[model samples]
Every structure is written in C-alpha cells, then in structure tokens.
Target: MSQAPASFSAVTPYRPSDAGRSLMVNDKHRQILDGLREISQESSSRGYHAKAVTSAVDGLRGCAFPVNSYLKDGNPNRRCIVYPDFEIEFEVGSYYGGPQTDVSIVDIRIFRSETKTNTRAALWNVTHTENESGSEWKRSRDPESQLKPTPKCSGTENDSIKIGINGFCKNIDHAISMLPSHITRGNETSLGKLKSSGYQLFYIPQSNSYFRAGWSFVRDLGRTSPSDLKSSQILASHMREAHENGLFIEWTSHRGGSKPLTQAMKLLAKQGVNVAGKQKVFLSDHTSSHFEADRARRAIGMNTTDSKWHNSTKGIAQLVGGQIFGGASLACSINELINHTKREELGGKIAVIGSTAIGGGIAINSTYEKIGKLIAEHGVSPALALSVLSVIGKTAIVGVAAASIPSLNENYHNGPQDPIKNLGNKIGKKLIPQG
Candidate 1:
C-alpha cells in the first residue's frame, strides 16, 4: 500500500457504503481494483513505471463517489470525473448475469495528470516517477518513434485523387486512378468496372465485419423533433411494406414515445396490416415534467412492480428480461456494443453473421428482386460471396414456406455462377498480394 499525498491525506479513503456495495450485490469494486492492478502490471512491463500505475490506481480509489447521486447509469461517461490537472474515467455494468449483479471498472482511463511544479507535482513525482532502482526513463526524441504528422490534403484535384492516407475520394476518375491497373480495368464485377470507368467510389481503409444489424443500427431513440416526425412517416411506410411482405418488424420507443408515429402505424394496421402478432410496438410512458430520475424512468417505460427500475441507471433496460419476441436479448451496454461492433482483420462480425444463417437469409431476401443487378453494380468479392450465400440460404427458407404455392420459387435461380467465380478470383488476388 502507498501513502496518500500530504495535502490530500486528510481526505477520507473512498470505500463503498454497505448500501452502495449492495447496489452491485456481487462486489464490483474489488473487480475494478483487480482489473486495474492487472492492467497496471501490463503497462509497467511495456515501459510505464510500476510506481506510477500504483499511484494512479490508488488515486482512482480515492476519487470514487457514490453513483446513486447522478442516477445516470446508461451514460457512457457517468462514472468519469475530470479535474483541472487530471482525468479519471471508467465503465460500469453487469451485462451478462442478473442485472442486479453488474460491475463497474475504470475501463476508459485512470488517473492521468500533467506534471507541473507545485506540492501536487512533488507528491506525484514521489509517488509515480521514482523507480525501485532509483532511476528514471525519459521519452524518446526520435522522429520515427514519434507519431507522423498528418499530411495536409487541400484543393480540388489533389483532394479528389489523394486527401490524407485515411481520406476518401469523391471523384470516380481519381479513385480508379489510385487502384492498380490490373484490378481497375480487369474483368471484375460492376464495382471493378466502375473503378476502371472512373466513377465515384469512396475509399475505406478498414472494413467492419458486423456490417448491418450491429451497434451502428442500435441508436438511442431520444426526444422526437420535426425531423423525427417526418422520418416517422418514412418509417411507417417501410413498416407497412414489411407487413405486406410478411416480414417481422418490431420497434421500441422511449423519450415519451411518438404519437404521430403511433398514429401512422395505427392507420397502416387498420389497412389489413398485421401490426401486433409476430412483430410488436413497445412503448414507455409519457415523459413527466416534475420527477426524479428514477420516477421519470417509471413514468416512461420501466415497470416498478418488478423492483428493477429503482436501481437501474436512467430507468431504461432490457424489456421483459430480454425476451426474444418482446425484450431484446442484448442491452445497451459497452460489452454488448463490443460484441456487435468489434471487427477483426478477416473474421469477427463477418464470421459471426455468416455463421448465424439469419444474415444469409436477410442478404438474399433483401435483394431477391435485384441480386444480379447488385452483383453487377457492386464488385464481387469474398464479402459479397458470403452475402450472396446468406441470401440463398434465406431464400431456401422462403422457398420452403412458399412450397405450398410453388410460385414463390418461379423467378428464383438455382445457383450462383459468374459472381461466385469472380469472387474467388478477387479473394485469390487478396491472398497473393500483387507487387
């Protein structure tokens, strides 16, 4: 254990009260401390002095405050507190097990402060800088070691061709010109021809695997505005179309819920649309003007009868214990977000989506009317092939469903031909980089 700073030694050591500990119910405070200790050790091995890591973790412990005061558990930055010289940030959640057994840890950042001449600086120096061997490590001055300055990409022609290393080009000619001659003018898919023809195609340095149905789509439905109302019309129409197409459509609304959106949905429902059976429309209560955070959450959507809303951050949580039909299996937690968003080089969301079998159905069914056109328009690649396969599998399910009628498979083709071969070639090119 390290000594507290002389100036702040009088400050009480931060420890959760019995009630606060009960909040986690399973001891998250210890978990956070353990995680920080492990991270500190790893950081030390990489170069940071162990003393600094210890001091930072200790300082973080000292900074802990009762979370009940804010009542904003959903806020990603809720646990974070910033001071004039330093900042401390962390994440809190128990996403897996019972919601009551969740945990909080300094997942974002711990104590990080600027060094200045003063008592604080002296305390920091004594606590963090000094090594057990009585030596100090200095930052390297080598230009190569330092981060390279971002290149300025200004002006039209140059910007169209090459902005920055991570920049994208709007001008199709410039985009194609940047690609290799073999790929650009080759007998690839429409996407490849587009490049050769000098059509606009934005450059994406990194590709995310969880393409659709990921965290990117999981947006917070906050207070509605004029734009939202207008968008609701579009949404209603889309929902109506999905209903006619016999696709399941479910939506949950918070922030007092939308009346106009509701009305639009009601109108569609009355017009022989199956609005409530397979899909559903979940609603929270109206947002109250005068109420505490917990009460507000209750007024909106949380069922206080369950006793879960009292401790829930901001009142919103997985509805009906994350039931597949009504409740979401995943909550709006950092861990859940990571599962949906995190992408690897070759696999990750891609593999997960492909493996699920649902993604394939979605891909094929989504483009049932325009599969060939899509392949022609977008260049065939490994990713596209996977998408096509997903579509095919989904189509097979639909075919099974429409087997009684048999007309459903009338326009559908037997198997993919040219596009599959083209995708293989593209994959080969990627596997064996052409120097």
Candidate 2:
C-alpha cells in the first residue's frame, strides 16, 4: 500500500473484531456495496466520472455513525474511527480510452463505525482534493479536478489489508456539513437531543436495484415554528420507523419539468429496478406529483395505486353510506311493525320487535363476514363488492320485515286467528247470499 499521508501517519491500520466482521457481511451492507459497484462501473462507462465518485461516496455515508446504528444488527455504542488520506487500488475494465486491464490508485478517506449492537466491519471510502493554491481545507468541485490517470496497485498479495472502493467523501468536514442542519447546528450541550432526534440514512431501495441509490436526509424538519415541532417530531419518528422496516421509500423532490417524477420512475423500471408493489413510497407534496406517483407506482407494480388521502375519502364515503342505509332500514322496519300491529296487545308488539331485531342483526353480520372473506381470498374490489352486497342485504332485510308483518298481524290481532279459516268463512257467506 502507498504510504499514509504525513498528517495521518499516526493513525493505526484498521482491524475489526470478529463481531464486526459479522455485522459487515449482513445483507444490507452487501447490497450497499454491490449497488456502489454497479454505480461506479455504469457511470464510468458513460464518462460521468464525477457522478460515479460522488455517488460512491454518498453510499459510504449511508453506512456511517448513527445511520449504521439503524441498520440491521448495528452497534449503537461503537465510536467512529477516521482514516484520513488513505490510498487503495482499483482494477477497472475500462477508463476513458485507457487499456482494458488498467489499475487506478485512488486516495480515499476511510471511516469505521458501529451499528446498534455490533461493530460494523466495512471500510468506507472518501476522497479529498487540494486546489492549485494548495490549501488543506479548500477543495475544488470541478469535475476535471476529480479525475486522475490510472496507476498500478501498490500493495502486494501478501499484504494483510485489502480495500475496495465502495464510497468516498471530500473530507470529514464535508461529510459533517452534508448532515441535516438540526444535528450539526446544535451546541455540544444538545448532544443528547441530537442523539434522540432519530436522524438516520435511508435509501430508495428501488434505486439501489438499478445501481443508483437515492438517499434522503430524514429528521424532523426544524424549519417550522415551535408549536408545530411536536407533531413534526411524531411524523418524523413514524417515517423513520417505516423506512427502517422496509415499508416505505422516499424520492428526492424533482424541481422542474411536467411529469418528471413519472418519467424518472419509468427510467428506474427500465433500468431493471422493479418499482411496483414492492413497498410504499413517499413523494413530497412540493413536487405536486402525488397523483403522478400513484399512477407510476401502479403502472410499475407498486402495492397500492391509491393515495392515502384517496383511500381515506373512500372509507369515509363508505361509512356514511352504511350509516344512512342502516338508519333508514331501521326506521322503515319500526314503522312497518307499528302500522301492521295497531290493534295487537303491547306484549305481542314487543315480541315481534325483539324477534325482528335479532334476526336482522344476525343476517347483516353474516352477510358482511361473507363479503369480507370473498374480498380477501378472491382479489375482489372491496368497494364494488361492498356496494353490491350492501344493496342485496338491505333488500333482503326489508323483505324479511315485510313478510313477517302479515303473520304477526294475524297472530296478535284479538286472538290467534287462522287466516285460512277466516278466508273460507268469508267465501261461504258470499256464496250463501244471506240465506
């Protein structure tokens, strides 16, 4: 390996414990590294060297400090170790128009940090550049300034340490600056507050599948007034939990172009990341693409095509409709019972009302249960099924009520009279003609 910079010579070589190695090899870590490799190779082929470098560095940042703590099996108490001006070699298949077997010596900064419960073993890559003026802290952002010619690997096969380029940052200060303002702006005394803030790195998993992982800065946006802070904090907490549980993904806001979000989603899908039906994704209201995102997510196979707002509205409508239908049915049933048994005794009236109520309740409950099962097992549209079944149920309820009215009237009027005998007597009197 190339000699460490004079300023970093005092830094010791990184050696992770066995526990750390296990943490590093977890699925999340491997997916991140694999994604970075994909980004590097693809972006380099397209001559987007700066993009490749920056994206790789950003991927590294995703594995750092408190962010890693949120990752699966990470140690929250582990301290961060920074290796400044570290050098490593990368074998590239192609570089600009260089030879196929060219090797590149890349100067990277490495950081070792722990997850929540175990030390993470992965080495993070960062790159720093000094301008022509040679100021230590000053770095150029120019794309051309970031490129370097290929060089042979300095370390031999016998070297104990082997490093690959996963990601890099310009410097430690740059990394700190990239953090959300809430954490970085607070004073040392607010360290506890910072720790409790629940800020962590989350990536768009779909983007990762396409080799271009998109990251978001997730924290309670402190831009609001103090009055809104509590609710904002709660929302932030829920969002963080959702992301950590793989139930949600978020996309960065798109600034311009009509339907840019849709186009971007399409591009992602075309690039081999399945965007449909995988996990719930959050689109900022600022983008005004809520409808667009839903359409894209559905077209791309996302789990649900409806927005939360849309679903909520549908639910409210269904609830209101059900209530109105139930109230009307109850009123009609009561009115029918009262009118049909006007001459019946009080005890008989009470019996009829109680029996009718019990039967109606049982029937409604059974119908709803059956409908629910059908929707769950057969992939039925809930709205359609409920609407159709509800109409059928209401009709059946009214029919049962109306059918019982005649029997109830005959049985409870004066005495238990036989309807067939009464009909025969009336017919006999008509035939005898008052003889």
Off by over 4 Å in 1: 1-9, 12-79, 82-86, 89-149, 153-435
Task: For residues 87-110, write the lDDT of model 1, one tens digit per residue.
Answer: 334433433333232233333233
Worst 10 residues of 2 by lDDT: 159-168
Which lDDT tens digits does candidate 2 get at residues 103-208? 2222333221221111221112223234787623221222121211112211222211111111112322332223222222223453333233212221110112
Q: Can you give the TM-score per candidate against the true fold? A: 0.17, 0.20
Candidate 2, residue 371: Cα displacement in angstroms equals: 49
lDDT of each: 0.29, 0.29
Error of 2 at 184 (Å): 28
lDDT of 2 at 341: 33
Error of 2 at 332 (Å): 29
